[model samples]
Target: MCYQLVERFSACRCLYFQHAVDPCEAYRQRGHSVQEKVVLVGYTCSRHSMRWSGNKARDSTLSDSGYSSIKG
Candidate 1:
């Protein structure tokens, strides 16, 4: 329900931001034990109108892991 004209930045590290714009609640997709856990994380830049995701096992969120947001 967020109608704010948000701006997206390449360096911006915000996952909940995607949820603000998208209909489906975008959450950190987590993995399982045997194959190692994976958290689906991404960033959205409204100003640039660009959305990018670090779909790698290493790319983790601030809340998910100790590392910072993925910047690429």
Candidate 2:
């Protein structure tokens, strides 16, 4: 039997929101504005779920030999 499946992934960039000031007294001593744009970084990871047969007994009866093999 051949099994087929599809997976989905999505990502979006966030717009600039706010600025912050450094209170360490180092940036202030340099006489430069410490305000900076907030940047967002993201990623996606996936786990697999088998599509078993509709019949519970049939699903259970299927051999486990190739069940764990993954195809990207």
Candidate 3:
């Protein structure tokens, strides 16, 4: 039996990282079966995560300044 770990970003479902394959005697054999373990990270990747937080901060600031009437 072989196992491969896949890590993904929770928000955008993007491939965040991958671990090395844990190979066994049956690895690469004709009838080999690979077990995949997927892990969803708690947060989004750095790129998108920062953008989301920044947007929240900006929105809050706008609301606090009595500018909520402004529409996109």
Candidate 4:
């Protein structure tokens, strides 16, 4: 059996909202803001549903003779 599983990734949740800092000089310099959105700086996953990024070999149940032996 092929132990190969596709890696799944999640979107950023913290960037769901937009805000403007009052003390930010750059914002004031523009006279008006371009209404810029927050660029996602990191990644996240819903660890609440399924266990994520755990030890593969140790937690895996697949047989040792599987194709995973040929680690490319």
Which candidate leads in lDDT? 3
The whole-model lDDT of each prediction reads 0.34, 0.32, 0.65, 0.34
- What is the Å distance of residue 34 in model 1 from its true position? 51
Model 3 steric clash total:
0
RMSD of each: 17.3, 17.7, 13.6, 16.1
Residue 18 in model 4: lDDT: 38
What TM-score do all the candidates reach, one by one? Answer: 0.15, 0.21, 0.56, 0.22
- Taking the tens digit of each residue's C-alpha lDDT, what string does model 2 give over 1-72? 112232222222333123334344455355544444333322222222233566542222222223221367
Off by over 4 Å in 3: 46-72
Error of 4 at 23 (Å): 7.0
For 1-72, candidate 3 gives per-residue lDDT tens digits of: 899988776666778778999999879789888898987764555555443464473222111222222277
- Model 2: colliding residue pairs: none
Give the winner by TM-score: 3
Itemize residue pairs with steric clashes in candidate 1: 7-46, 7-47, 8-45, 8-46, 8-47, 9-45, 29-40
